[model samples]
Every structure is written in C-alpha cells, then in structure tokens.
Target: MEENFKMVAKTLFGFEEILAKELLQLGAQKIEKGVRSVSFYGDKGFMYKANLGLRTAIKILKPIHAFSVHNENDLYNAIYKMPWENYLSPKGTLAIDATVHSPLFKHSLFIAQKTKDAIVDKFRNTTGQRPNVDLKFPDIKINIHIDRHQCTVSLDASGESLHKRGYKTATNIAPINEVLAAGMILLSGWDGQCDFMDPMCGSGTILIEAAMIACNIPPNLMRKEFAFERWQDWDVDLFEKIEASLLNKTRDFHYKITGYDKAPSAIAKARENIKYARLEDFVHVQHEDFFKTRKGGHQKLHMVFNPPYGERLNIDMQDFYKNIGDTLKQNYPGTDAWFITSNLDALKHVGLRPSRKIQLYNAKLEARLVKYVMYEGSKKQKYMK
Candidate 1:
C-alpha cells in the first residue's frame, strides 16, 4: 500500500474554496486552503486521480524539499544537495518554474535559472554528465517557491495546465480559459438540474464544461499526458485503475445544454470543439444573435457566459452591455443569467443590478462574475428588488 503525501493544487484567484471543496470530495486528507492554492494529503493513486479529475486546478505540485535561504549561494547549495539522480537520469531533460513572494528573492526567472544550474551542476559533478534543459518537453518539471526566506522545492505532477483538457482544437478571438469556465460554472451552483445556455458562447467553453459537470465527468479524461508519467515510480496500471474508477462515476444528464453565437465562424469553432470532446449528443451550438432571441421553454434555465469586455474587439462597450441587459430583461424570463467581464464601467451599463458579484481575474485583467436573475412573471416584476 502506498502512503499518503502532501500535494498542492494551484488554481486561479477566487477559486481556492471551490478547489478545496473538490479535494475534500475526492477524499483528500488534511485539506488546507491558501491564496489561489489548496493543499491536501493523498497517496500516489490519489495524486493520479487529482491530475485527472481536478477541473479548477492549473497544476498539481508535490513538495519534495523545503529550507530557508537568505542568498543565492544558500539557494544553490540547498538545491544541489538533493538526490536529483533518483528523480531524473543523466540523459533526461529538465525544466524549472519559479514563483517568488519574498523580498529576499526578486526575479523568478533568475531563481528558475539558478535552480536549474544547481541541479545540472550537481549531476555533472557526480556522474560526469548532466541532464539537458528542455522547456517544451522535459522529463522532470520542478517548481521553486520563495515565501519570505523559506524556499520549497516541488515536482510538477501536471506537465501542462489542466485547462488544455485535450479537447479544444479550435477557438474564437477571445476564448475563456477552461479552468476559469469550469470554476465559474461550479460557483454558479448549477448541478444538471435545469437547462443550461451560453448566449455569447465563444468557442463553446462554458457549454462543454457545463455538460461535463452535468454528467459528473472527470475534466481531464481526454488529456494526453501528465508529468507523473515520466516519474521514476510511474505506475501505469495504477493510473489505469484510477481512470476507470472515475469513468464509472459519470451519471446521465437529462437537461439540455445549448450555446449561441452571433458569428458563424464562432459557431463553427464551437461545434468543432464540441464534436472533438464527443459531447455532440449533450450539447448544441447555433449561429444566432443573442439580442434577437428569446427563451424557448418555460422550464427553469441557467445561463453562464463570457461576453466581450471591449478588450480586443472594437464594439461599443456601453451599448453592447445595455443590449445584454435589455435582451435578458425583455426576452428571457425565469432564467439565472451569469457572465464575467473585466469592464467595470460597461457592467454598469447593463441596467439590471447583479444579484451576486464575485471578484475574479481573467488572465491579468481584474474581472467580476456577476449574476442577474430574471423571473418567470411579468417583465415589470421580473428582476429582484
């Protein structure tokens, strides 16, 4: 039996609680929440499960060593003393990613370079050969973090961001991150109970994530690889068992999941991506302007989307947002409309007050996930007072 070890799942801002909840539901022990991160204790099999199942996590890191450092030499010496040979071979390739939150260490790039140097030098001095650095494809990906004077070294268990999901082959002008899309859907409290829609579905990310959530599907089942596949103790049979276990948990979804886009190109991309995900039976994409459309059925509906924030496009921010509000208020009733945008000024133009506003980050831009509830009754009494 494999003993449990601590692992950290790194997530975006405003998603720590959800990630922690996900870990807890996945049977992680000693769960702890941090800023944009959640830590927990899980065995090797569980680690494989996390990388394969966690939707909100950008990466999963397993901390291997920790020490305090005041200077560069201390950092180098501390990292050089580790048993790198056990984790990588002399001919293997390596990559280092660093994050610094300490006054002692300033540049993350320099920190990454220094850490890589220490490992390479250690191997060269001991075995007369060293691993080569391969940023694109590496056998071992290391993570270095500096908080104040404490340095913790970790192994990257997820090679690429879990958002890749191995399903999206096409995207529109501004496609939302898959992790952010899933996080927003999870936060909205929609659990396949009602009909789901993404009116401004750029590439259909929200729709796909909603279907996956609705079916209780593991998000990373289509992913090509994880970093642990290259680890020294990589267990193929164990990983297969974990994957099979997750697949068995997927339940059938009965509600409709649909997407709409004003552009035909966006619709094509969304359909392509949706077909690639093998969710064609559960999701439908149409090329139609949202402003001209009305709710089709009287059943309770849930809408989550990433509308343009007037960032890269040249659309009128005020009128665009006003139309969003007008369409929802007049056309769609009995719907919980939720959307994310970084344009604070434009959000005010929506006219309808948001029932809930959550501070989040869309890439580097500060954003808000706002919800507007449109009731089923008369238009005058639709909005919450």
Candidate 2:
C-alpha cells in the first residue's frame, strides 16, 4: 500500500475555502485551509486525482522538508541535505521557483539561484555529474518559499499553472484567467440548475468552465502535462485509473450554457475554444450586442461574466456601465446578473443595489464581484443606490 503524505494546493486569494471543499470531496484527509492555500494528506494516486480534478487550485505541492533559516547559508545547507537522488537523476533537467515574504530575503530569484547552486554542487561533488536547468520542461520542478525565519521546500506536482486548461487556442484582448473564471462560476453558486449565460464572453473561457462545472467534468482532463508525469516514480497506469474514476463521476448537465459578444472575431474565437474543449454540444455562442438584446424564455437565468473594465477596451466607461443596468432593468426579468469590475466608480452607474458584493482581486487590480437580482414579474422593483 502507498503511504500518505502531506500536500498543499495553492490558489488565488479568496478561493481557499472553495479549494478546501474541493479537496474534501476528492476524499482527501486532514484538510486544512491557509492563506491562499489548502493542505491535505493523500497518497500518490490521490495526488494525481487532485491535480486533475481541482478547478481553483493554481498548483499542488508536496512538501519534502521545512527548516528555520536565518541566512542564505542556512538555506543552502538545508537544501543540500535533501535526497535529490530519490526524485531526479544527476543528468536530468530541473527548475526552481521561489517566493519570499521575509525581510531577510528580498530577491526570490537570488534565492532560487542559490538553491539551484546548492543542489547541483551537492550532486557534482558526490557523483561528478550535475543536473541542468530547464525552466519550460523540467524533470523536477522545485518550489522554495520563505516566510520570516521559516523556509519550506516542496516539489511542484502540477508543472504549469492549472489555469492552462489546454482548451483555449486563441484569445481576445484581456481574456480572463481560467482559474478566475472557474472560481467566479463557483462563487455564483450555479449548479447547472437553469440556463447560464456569459453575455460578454471573451474567448469563451467562462462558458467552457461553466459547462465543465455543470457537468461535473474534471477541469484538468485536457491539460497537456503535469509535473508528476516526469517524476522518477511516474505511474501511468495509476494516472489512467484515476482519470477513469473521475470520468465515471461526471454527471450530465441539462441546462444550456450560452455566450455572446459584440465582436464577430470574438465570437469566432469563442467557438473555436468551445469546440476545442468538446463542449459545443452543451454550449452555444453568438455575435450579438448584449445591450440591444432581451432575455428569452421564462425559466430563471444565471449570468456571470467579466465585462470591459475600461482599461483595455476603448469605450465610454460611464455610458457603458449605464447601458448594462438599463438593459438588465428593461429587457431582462427573472434573472440574476453577476459581473466583476475593477472600476468601482463605473459600478455606481449600474444604478441597482448589489445584494452581494464580494471583494476579490484580478491580477494586481482590486476588484469587486457584485450581484444584482432582477425580479420575475412586472411588480415594481426596488432599485437601491
């Protein structure tokens, strides 16, 4: 039987709870949430499953060692004492990614370089051979994190960011991150209950993520590679078994997932991405200005999107935001609209009081995910300030 080991899944800010819940559902034990990260105990196969199944996780890391380091020499000596031979050969390629939050260490790159030097020097002294660095494709990807006087070293189980879901072949200007898109849909609490729409869908990221969530599909199933696949103990059969298990758990989605864009080029790119993800059967995309269209059918609709935040697209911010509110108030009823924007000033022009406003971040910009509920009937709706 395989032994259980502790692993941590890092995510964006404000997604730790959702990521922890995802780990819990995946049968992980000892689940605990930290700032922007979740730690759990699982075996090798469970590691594969977590990497494949988690939607909001940025990367899953297996902690090998932790120590108190007061200076660079302590950090180097601690790293040199590790059994790197168990994970990679002296001839294999390697990569180091470091993050520092301590006043003692200001440059993460220098820390990474010091780590690389320590590992290579140890190997060369012992075996007269050293591993080379390959940032893009490495046999072993190492993560170094220093917080105050404590340092933790881990092996990155997911090579690239999990956000690279391998579905988007093309992108429009300022496309939303896949991890962010999935997190947004989950935050909206859309469980494929009714129709879903991304009225300003760009490259169809939100729509693809929504379909996957609604159908219980694993997000990383289509990813090109994971860092674990190159490890010394890589298990193809175990990975396939985990994949099959996840596939077996997938439930069919009954509601339609739709996307719209004013640009024909965006529509084309969205269709291409949706087709790539093999979600065309469940999703539909069209080129239509959302302001000029009205909601169809009587069933309740759930909408989530990342509309223009006035930074990339050249548009009048005040008028554009007003039109969004006007369209929802006049054309759409029985609908719940949710969107994220960095422009808090423009958000005021929406004119409807947000029942829920959650603070989040879009890369570096502070953003808000606001929700506005449009009533079902012709009864007078309270448009709060």
Candidate 3:
C-alpha cells in the first residue's frame, strides 16, 4: 500500500477557507489553512483526486523535503545533499520556482537559481553530466519556499496551474482568470438548485464553470497532463483508478445555465469556449445588452460574473456600473447577483448598497466580490428594506 503524505494546495488570497472546505469535502484529512494555500494529508490516490477535483486550487504540491536555513549557502547545501536520483534522472529536464517570505532570502528568482544549481552541480560533479533545465516541458518541476528562515521543497503536481482548464480558446480584452471564475462560482453558494446566469457574460467562463460545478464534474478532466505524470513514481493504474472514481461521482444537473454578452465578439468567443468545454448543451450563450434585458421568468436566479473594471475597456465606467444596479433593481427581481470588479470607484455608482462584500485580489489589483439582493415587488421591497 502507498503511504499517506502531506500535500499543499496553493490558492489565491481570500480563498484559503473555501479551499480548505473543498479539501475536507473531497475527503482530505488533517487539513490546515495558510496564506494563499492549504495543507492536508492523504495518500497518492488522494493526491490525484485533489488535483482532479479541486475548484479553487491553482496547483497541488507534494512536499518531499524541508529544513531550517540561515542563508543562500545553507539552502544550496541542503538541496545538494538530498538524493535526487529517485525523483529525476540526470538525463531528465527540470524547472524550479521559488517564493520568498524570509529576511535572509529576499529574491525568489535568486533562490530558484540557487536550488537549480545545487541539484545540477551535485549531479555534474559526480557523473560529469547534469540534468537540463527546460522551463516549458520539464520532466520535473520543483518549488522552493522560504518562510522566515524555514525552507521547504516540494514537487509541483499541477502543471501550468489548474486554471488552464483547456476550454478557453478565445478571450476578451479583459477576461477573468479561470481559477478566479471557478472561485467566484464556488463562493456564490450555488449548487445547481435552480437556473444560473451571468448577465454581462464576457466569455462565458462563469457559465461553463457553473455547469461543471452543477454536475460535480472534475475541473481538470480536460487538462493535457499533470506534473506528477512525469515523476518516477507515476502509477498509471492508480491514476486510472482515481480518475474512474471521480468520474463515477458525476451528478446530473436538472437546471439551466445561461450567459449574455452585449458584444458580438464576446458572444462568439463565449460560444467557442462553451463548445470547447463540451458544455454546449448544458450552457446557452446569447448576444444581448444586460441593462436592456430583464429576467426571462419570475423564477429565482443565481448570477456570477466579472464586469468591465474600466482598466482597459473604455466604456462609461460609472454609467455602465449604474446601469448594472438599475437593471438588477428594476429587471432582475428575486435574484442574487454577484460580480467581482477592481473598479472601487465605479462600484460607488451602483446605487444600491451591496448586501455582502468580500475582499479579494484579481491579479495584483485589490478587488471586491460583492453580492446584491433584488426584491420581487413593492411588497417584497418593504421586506428587503
């Protein structure tokens, strides 16, 4: 039997608690949350499941070694002394990524270089040959992290991040990141219960993400490969078993998921992306301005989207946002609308006060993921008040 091991799932800021909840729901054990990451214990099969099933995770890392470090030299010496033979051969290619949170080690790029040098130099000194570094298609990807003089090394189990879900072939001028899209959907508390929507759907990312969430589908089933597949201990049978088990857990979604984009190009791109995700039947895309339209029926609705932040797309920022508020208040009654935007200035224009606002990051820009509740009628308006 394969032994249980500790693994870390890296995520974006403000998603640690949600990611930890996801890990626990996925049957992970001894889960611990950290800044932009969550650590837990599970077997190799569990690792495969976490990689395949997690929605908010950016990457899953399996820590192979850890030690205390005083400086760069100590970091290099420790990496050099490890038995690298079991993980990668001298003939294989590798890539190193480093993150620094230590006073001693300030530069991440420098740490990556030192760690890579330690491994290759150790091999070259003994065998007159060294493994090559291939950033694009490396056989092994190593991650180095220094936290206040404590250094930890791990194998990057997720290749190219899980957000590259292999579905988006087209993008708009400012499309949201896939992981962020999934995270928003997960945070919205939607469970395929009723119909879903993204009124200003730019590329249909939220719609596709919603469909997958509804079906309990594995987010990375379409990914080309995981980094662990290149590891020496890559167990094909166990991986297949894990894949099959996750596939079996897929559920049927009875509700509809839909998207609307005002721009023709965005609608075309959304259609293309929905097709690529193989969710065309489960998701519908239409070209319609959100403010001009109202809810199709009196049914309850769930929405998640990223509207223009006025960063690159030059629409009337305040007016556009005000229209969003008006549309929801007038047209989209009995709906829970959620959108993430970096436009703090524009959010002020959205007349109605947000019911809930959560701080998050959309890349380097600090942003807010907010929710609003639109009532059904004047009778309900009193209740909302």
Listed in order, each prediction's TM-score against the native is 0.97, 0.98, 0.97
Instruction: Show how many residue pairs clash in every candidate, following the order shown.
Output: 0, 0, 0
Candidate 3 per-residue lDDT, tens place, 1-385, comes to 8889999999999999999999999999999999999999999999989999999999999999999999878998999999998898988999999989977876899999999999999999978889999998899999998889799999999979898888889998877888898888888899999999998888888898899999998999999999989988899999999999989998998888989988999999999999998998799988898888989788899988898887868789988999999999888888999999998999999998999999999999999999998777864565778
Compose the digit string of candidate 2's lDDT tens values, residues 1-385.
Answer: 9999999999988898889989999999999999999999999999999999999999999999999999999999999999999998999999999999999999999999999999999999999999999999999999999999999999999999999999999999989999999998899999898999999998999999999999999999999999999999999999999999999999988888989999999999999999999999999999999999999988999999999988888899999999999999998898999999999999999988899998888988999999998987654543431
Show where candidate 2 strays beyond 4 Å. 378-385
As a whole number from 0 to 100, the lDDT of residue 202 in candidate 3 is 84
Per-residue alpha-carbon lDDT of candidate 1 for residues 15-34, written as tens digits (9 for 90 to 100): 99999999988899999999
lDDT of 2: 0.94
What are the Cα lDDT values of the candidates? Answer: 0.94, 0.94, 0.91
Model 2 residue 285 distance off true place after TM-score fit, in angstroms = 0.7
Give candidate 3 misplaced runs (Cα > 4 Å): 379-385
Rank order by TM-score, top first?
Answer: 2, 1, 3
